[model samples]
Target: MTLSLFSQFSSPSLLGIPLIIAALTLPWLLLSLPSGRWLNSRMTTLHEWFIARFTNQLFLPLSIKGHKWAPLFASLMLFLFSLNMLGLLPYTFTPTTQLSLNLAIAIPLWLATVLIGLRNQPTHTFGHFLPEGTPTLLIPVLIIIENISLIIRPIALGVRLTANLTAGHLLIHLVSSAVFTLLPSMTSIAVLTAILLFLLTLLEVAVAMIQAYVFVLLLSLYLQENC
Candidate 1:
């Protein structure tokens, strides 16, 4: 029973191989790529349009130097969105729910932005640690606080994603389990629980999409700051 309840977060494996690899790769396969033909299919056209719009909106605020990262940002956004939405299916694992995986993704990208800032404008980047018009005594304290906040951004990114997904999944699991348990005895209550489950499922779907967008949006914001 315990295993069954917590099993959703566990990485599924076959023999000695982990299925997380398949999960990570599956989203890319599912995306329809444009062909070499003069005309495009409806799905392909819509896909291209959606990506184009997303990239435009995302990079609209950034400078020309930041425009170069449009491809990476768009691809990461789609990859995360796909992973999140797909994980909502029954019997699928959510890679984003794993803190390690989330951290792995967040840290590298976060570091890249920071490195870009440091490399291109080291003085500007360092200047972020200490704001202007600070008093003599508070300067040291403010600098420490600012540095800590700067360092915590990636960890915050990872934890926010992990915690939200994990909490939602657990709630769904518990509610569904309750529905099953109650259905055999309490018909009316079970029906109500089922309705709640449906609503929660819908909420989860929205959350899945929003979280993906938020993750990418925050990255873009970071890029905007650095650029």
Candidate 2:
């Protein structure tokens, strides 16, 4: 009875107030806080282990200046990972599917990195616009190109996250609708389609995780450049 499939992305509300903050905070409820005891629960231990390993591997290639970004990046990875996984559940919404929210997260972080580079190492950052070469004629063109590309990073980051999640959700919904429509008339084909839907759902689960990782990974790379 829905008029538009895109309605699924609409934020839910209560008493005319949007539930955006609640949706964003839902992931934190799943995490267990560390205690003062000598032993921690399995999930807590695993969480800590993954955080340590992820932070270590991600920032290893960067300079010491970049090491300061580990806490921010690690927290972001976990937050994105949780929201993405939770969205796979029935009746749940993915905030990352909203381009506005994604852009809000991406632009400030990307701009901060660029600003840091300019503030801390202005000459080196300026060097990125043009490499050492004898092409005097192409300097303006190359500088313009590099500057545009630099400006596009945050937009790309937001769009990538939004597009990937939106596509996967749409595909899943389409296949599910097809399965329902075919069920009563053509049982055998519907069964096969249902199986395919199951596999696709599994694939989507992987996509959710990968997209989150890629989001955080690109941010780390940007931080690496600036730091």
Candidate 3:
């Protein structure tokens, strides 16, 4: 039973081709591109408004140099948000639940911020390793600790996203399983469990959206530090 619960995280495939590829690419294909018209559809109008607001909030704290990243970060956030929300549908696989996928997205972006800092401000970047007013005895230790923390950022980002989605999916699976089991012999208990399952599903939906936002927000914060 425990193994079966976790099996949902495995990549699904058909005819030897992994469906995870589709899961990753389908969101982009489904999104509508803006049409060149005097008046846009309501959905397109709302979509544009959301993107504009998100870009404004995301870059508000960033300096002029960092503003250039608005498009990349906005697209990333939308991609992640779409993946997370789509995964909630029944019989669909969520690529983000896989640590490898999350790490693939995280490491390059994190490294880009680090490289930007190194390229543009070497002294400031290196200075992050050791703070001011440190005693000589602890300087080496602090540098090592800071280096370790810096290296862990991408790993933390990946693990955080993977773990949250995985846990929520697992919980929903277990509870839904319990609901079916109880329905045979305890109608009242089964109905109550079903209600609980509905609430949990809603919570998972919120978690999905928030985790995507957090992942992008952290990246923006990293860019801010570098730029």
Candidate 4:
């Protein structure tokens, strides 16, 4: 049998990408309203000291006039990371495995970085896109490369996430399916594959958190550089 790249997408609609994202997000949204008060209260705890310091540095542009966007951004990261982990489950769709979904997220992240940079230092924001210490003679060449790289970041981010999840899921599915098919009489083989898949699921959870952290970390660094 020929392997399909998107065989997972052909599954039942309830487990598809659109529903998966909604399923993961609805609870967070519903609970967040009530949780906001409690969260706000707890925000002053000692555990939040380092977080506040980091937030101050990253949101310096937004925090200039006693404004702070870290909570909203933090919420977004939590939602995305949870959604990503959901994809690692058996018979469940990972919305992030789809390029479109990842692109939707990555594009906004890139734009947010640019917007914050511009808000902080409009003149330098655009200038930073051009290499800092490059000679004027090579300014044109540097601009072309820098602009291309800047535009490519979101695309690359989307592809990196989607491809990893998609490939990993497909590999697991193939192995599980093969064991089921080839050793129909041997339950042990199928069981082994299932155990392996479970281990991979744990790994996927770690990867999801790491990917979310990486995205936000890079965004903060980008803001720092532009600022």
**Mind giving the per-residue lDDT tens digits that candidate 3 earns over 20-132?**
99999998987778999999988788878988999999999999999999889989988999999999999999999999999999999999999999999999999999988
Q: How accurate is candidate 4 locally (lDDT)?
A: 0.67
- Pitting candidate 1 against candidate 4, the one with the higher TM-score is 1
For candidate 4, the per-residue lDDT at 118 reads: 78
At residue 42, candidate 2 shows an lDDT of: 96
Q: For each candidate, what TM-score against the reference?
A: 0.96, 0.96, 0.98, 0.72
Pairs clashing within candidate 4: none
Model 4 stretches astray by more than 4 angstroms: 1-5, 10-21, 27-67, 185-195
lDDT of each: 0.92, 0.90, 0.94, 0.67
RMSD score of candidate 2 (Å): 1.4
When summed lDDT is taken over every stretch of 10 residues in candidate 3, the lowest stretch is 41-50
Arrange candidates, best lDDT first.
3, 1, 2, 4
Using alpha carbons, what is the TM-score of model 4? 0.72
Off by over 4 Å in 1: 1-4
State which candidate has the highest TM-score.
3
Tens digit per residue, CA lDDT, model 1, 9-30? 9998999999999999999998
The local lDDT score (0 to 100) that residue 193 gets in candidate 1 is: 99
What's model 1's overall lDDT?
A: 0.92
lDDT of 1 at 178: 94
